[model samples]
Target: MSLHPFSQRPRYSQWFTAKPQTVVVQPTTWCNLDCTYCYLPFRRLKHEMSAEVSDALAESVAAFADGAHPIDIVWHGGEPLALGPRKFTALLTPFEELRRVGRVHHYVQTNATLITEAWCELLTRHEFRVGVSIDGPAALNSQRVDLRGRPAFDRIVRGIDRLRVHDIPFSVIAVVGTDGIDHPEELLDFMAGLGCRSVGFNMEEAEGINTDRQQPTPEQAETFWRRTLEWSRCHAGELEVRELEYLGEYLRMIRAGQRVDWDRRRLDPIPTVSWNGDVVLLSPELADTTDVGYGNFLAGSVLDRPLTDILGGAHRLRYVQEFLAGLEGCRAGCEFFDFCRGAQAANRYFENGSLATTETNYCRVTRQALVTALSTVAAKEKEETV
Candidate 1:
């Protein structure tokens, strides 16, 4: 995995984190419900991971798992639970020994429509952290529908209720598009009432197959974050918003005059393994996307090569090289570089059509807008104190 002399510069030497903190595994791609804004390319297809794939993944995980830092094995997909409890449990069996030694932790990002008492028992017994994808109340969640185009909200809530009954704590991931952004207070109230551990907002973007997305304007984005921050402050400590939490930490670091160590600020590889065992490094959103230049975004297959070896050679990929160059551009240009480090690879590719570029509507709305909102609020608060 050698690079040109220019790429061998000190700054580019450690561009990517060799040991990733998280690995997303696609157990299956058979999603029951059809969400309107899904970006997955093969969501309609049914593909289950073979036992050999899991065994190979376990071997890769074992090689990376040191006792000090526990790697998060996130089971993500077209809907991981679509595989059902029994089959899913078999998949979990491979990592059981690694988990017992506290070298790995399991997490599942699911739609929650398939959750049952059996699923709850499996999740609890395995201590798997659950993340549910629900936009808002029934109206806002209308986009999540069954194959018959019927709203799946009732079923989703039913599944969540089962989780509650079993005392399983879970976080909520709400997709906020033009519809839900304006009603921040209402959205906050709805999420807080769910008794979720935390809330994360995912702004809709034109990614993968979901092109022609209607994105919010810059003003609307800023206002939405401003209002959301205001609402969060009013109900302080009642709900933990992921963006606001990160904002707070960033502000504190800035105030303390802490500069980013560019060398140490390497991007996490975040290897996303497809059901067939193909590994896509960096963003999980890059798993199935393809380009003429980058091919199918695959670094290598875990079944054929060790995960560590695949990651080691990741920097040599054409897209990864371009992404590194883009990061350098971002570091040199954007004022928000310290906050975001560098914006996401998927956003740059999907929205801007190239990974070798910087600035996109996705980053402007999600990253810059939040920073502007919080900085304004903090400055005004400081004035009042004086």
Candidate 2:
């Protein structure tokens, strides 16, 4: 048996495993809305995963389970809710046993336009962690529209209202494009107004089908993050900001003289099982976005082998090897390696068109910028205390 090469790294030796901490399952590929920055290439195809596939996943996912930390089974989609409540519930049936045993926790990333009372009931009953995708207020959210190019902001907000009425807690994920970067406070206020438990930001990047959109300049990106962190600190305890929270954790790790610990093995081989059981490892955005150079990013299939086995051999794939090399590149050349790691595989592939390169606008803006801002803020706060 070959030892996973990642385990050889000191930071990964303790927790390296073939099983992924998160499994992204695509229930269906039919999205109800068209967002300007949407990355999915097959969103128009209304394909749904067969029950057999979910059964296979439920059976195989047990091997990935840790003691108290349930493996995250994220039901991502073109719009998972596009499957609607009935069809979606049938899809959930296979995982009920695992969910009951506390071995798996389900999360859904939805556009939230289809969020109805039935959807809220299903969400509440399943106890699934809900993540709603809405960029911001109506003016800021013009990018998200229906198939007819009708703005979806009002419908999205309506769905959120339903979730709130049902007491279904959710977190919001906003895509911060160049236009939205300058309006952090406005975005923050709008999202916080929705009563979401937390918020996360995704910078508009040249990824998948949305490659033509203009990205924020490095200076603008830095200013956005600095102000974001500043606002997050002021609103501390009111809402959790994902990037800010991650920054705090990273800073804490540094303060304690601890190595990064690979941050869940650098999220290696995060299996994204498509409707037909085809697995795309690492970045979920790579699903259905084929590059012949990268073997279409298809690592393996749950139909052919257990997810564990595929992940076990992930390091041997040619593209994965290049990605690992990219990590080394970051470690050696970039000072932010400990903070940003190698960056996301999709970012590397989409921005530079290779998994073997390092340093993307994404890592610079999201990771490096956030780290610098947080460090500066921490130092200033420390001085004030002294």
Candidate 3:
């Protein structure tokens, strides 16, 4: 895990907190629906995790959680519920003993395609937080179809209906496409109707297998955020839009003229683990991607190594080294460096073809434009107050 002297300094070390507050585990890679913009390269591989491996990972993570800081295990997959009742139960059974004395919370990000009554009961009993992935209404979710190319929107709606009936509180994460960009207010209204307390927006990214992505201009992004802000004010305390939340926090820190600190949570690999115990550090999106130098973006295997050792193994991956160097370049060059430290690794790698670069079309539209838009709105409000 040793690195050259020059690569020793990481910007993350400057802002110290818990390195990985969350670990995303892929219990299986067998997803039912094939969303057009999915980044999972092995979404149809049907690889299920061995209980032995799961037990070993839990042991490793439980030891990490023993340090007294609360950590979360985010169960993700091609889709977690795809593991079915017996298998999913077995997957989580490893944590039963660990949960008694430690602060290890369970969460699952699902497509909600297979959320049944049984699933709700299991989640509730275990107190697993749920995040459903769905884009707006049926028309907006046309790209999220089944293997047979038929729209699965109706099934998704049915699942949401069941979640509501069961009194399960959940958040929604939607991929914003050209259609979403064109109709921001309409998209917001649709998700609010579904009873989601908070909504996360991931603009169509150029990552993994999905290479054919069209990015909106910065002006278009700013306009969309402005409109969405106006719509959100109408429902103020009810709906929480994640993008606006991040931007607003950034603006507050800047306006107060305080020394800014980076959010370690969003900074890097939040530690994504595969079914077989392969640990991909830093970028969750790096789980399914490959680099010539780092192979499958793996730093270490929890089944074979300690979590402490795996984190040390980060410097061993040239991909991470390059990412660290790229982050240095970003700090030196970009005006937005304080707000975003080189952006997400997968997006930077996929869009710019290198980690040591900055400012892709992705950042230009989302982070940069949102900042401009929010600042403008704030300035206008201040003038009106005068």
Candidate 4:
């Protein structure tokens, strides 16, 4: 029987009729630091969410958690800590209640500068998995400075030290810039010495508010990642590298005879809910656009629209379908699609004009570097076994 395009049945669903497994909630559009690479342009904004709105959002998410699937709530930009301790705790009450019944997991992605002793205590008390943003050591962190052109390394280090002193387990996220590309071994050593249990490395994405004049070239990126992997193999201690997480997950899928979720061009359409209850599709970078499809916040006020209505809107549905179709191209053609998440929508929007486009420059660099390194490692292992 000949396969029909529409009837072929995408390995993943074509549309989302249910709530997302993970939802990113922004408590305030305010941020303390002016990181050059921030996607939110948060430093320019002063919109703080009211406690009432935060409560309503929690209730809306709670409604979604009414289902059986595991749910994760991520406190995302612009610096969720800007919500302050009292408001942050207020926002947590609804989700925390759900956790009592063992129904929810909470995560926070933050720039460690705002991390205080109190914040560390609350995070550890609630068992929240924290991911701190720090781009390697002081020298490499020069680019990741405040608006006043002051290096934030000392403050960030102090914040991290507070976490350590308070016995709060946390992970580090380092942005790999051109400088970092030149010293992969040094960067890895710096991160390892921080005593963070895990680390995630992100290429300085040239998207949103991040208009960094200089970015690493594709060749530089490839070399940096290649060397980083070699360093990782040699230092295979308690350190968990987030960049390798997707690859590890993909390999796990292969071992289990299963397909990866993000790799299949599937739209896991993680919703980023702003403090005032506006929902943006995928990452916060999409929320930074001035264009129609760019800052397309389809669903507003979860109190007004049913979660079903928001997920089923024509714009959202079309975007999801188009995104999935784009993935089909990857699955059919790209050899490295299984390992990478086909590049992020934010990178595509910034580099190309649209999110539905084919492989991105980021993808090209990552796939070429990662696959080559993995192949070399596998071959060496085979030879050693022989």
Please tell me which predicted candidate would have the highest lDDT against the true structure: 1
Of the two candidates 1 and 3, the one with more favorable TM-score, higher being better, is: 1
State TM-scores per candidate.
Answer: 0.95, 0.92, 0.92, 0.87
Model 3 per-residue lDDT tens digits across residues 1-386: 23673555454354223356888999998899998888889988899999988888888877668637767889998888999988888988888766656668888998888999999999888888899999998888888998888998999989888899999999999988776788887888898899987998887888888898675667888888778887877778868999888767776876887543434434535788899888887677788676656676878888889776677556656777777777777778888877765657777788888776677877877787777777777787899999
Candidate 2 or 4, higher lDDT? Answer: 2
- Report the lDDT tens digits of candidate 2 across residue range 1-386: 23466654443323235457889999999898988788889888889989889888877797778567789999999899999899889889988888888988989999999998899999999998999999999889999999999999999899999998998889999999976999999999888888999999988888888888898877787778788878887887877889888877877776886654535443546789999999987789889987787789898889889887887767656667677678778889998877776759889998898888999999988888877776777787899999
Clashing pairs in 3: 268-282, 269-282, 269-283
lDDT of candidate model 1 versus the reference? 0.87
Number of clashing residue pairs, candidate 3:
3
Stretches of model 2 off by over 4 angstroms after superposition: 1-17, 260-266, 375-386
Clashing residue pairs in candidate 2, if any? none
Q: Quote model 1's TM-score.
A: 0.95
lDDT of 4 by residue, 1-386 (tens): 12343543342345332457777877777777777667776555867766666677666666767546757888887878877887888788867777666567789988888888789878976778888889888889887677687888898898889888988788888888777879988888988999998887777767876765477777787677778888888989857787776677777887887764443344456777776677767556666456754336354556576444565452434444455556667667888766664546667667766656767767766665667767767777899999
TM-score of 3: 0.92
Question: Model 3, residue 45: what's the lDDT?
Answer: 89
Model 2 Cα shift for residue 272 (angstroms): 0.2
Clashing pairs in 1: none
Q: Give candidates' CA RMSD values in order.
A: 2.0, 3.1, 2.5, 4.0
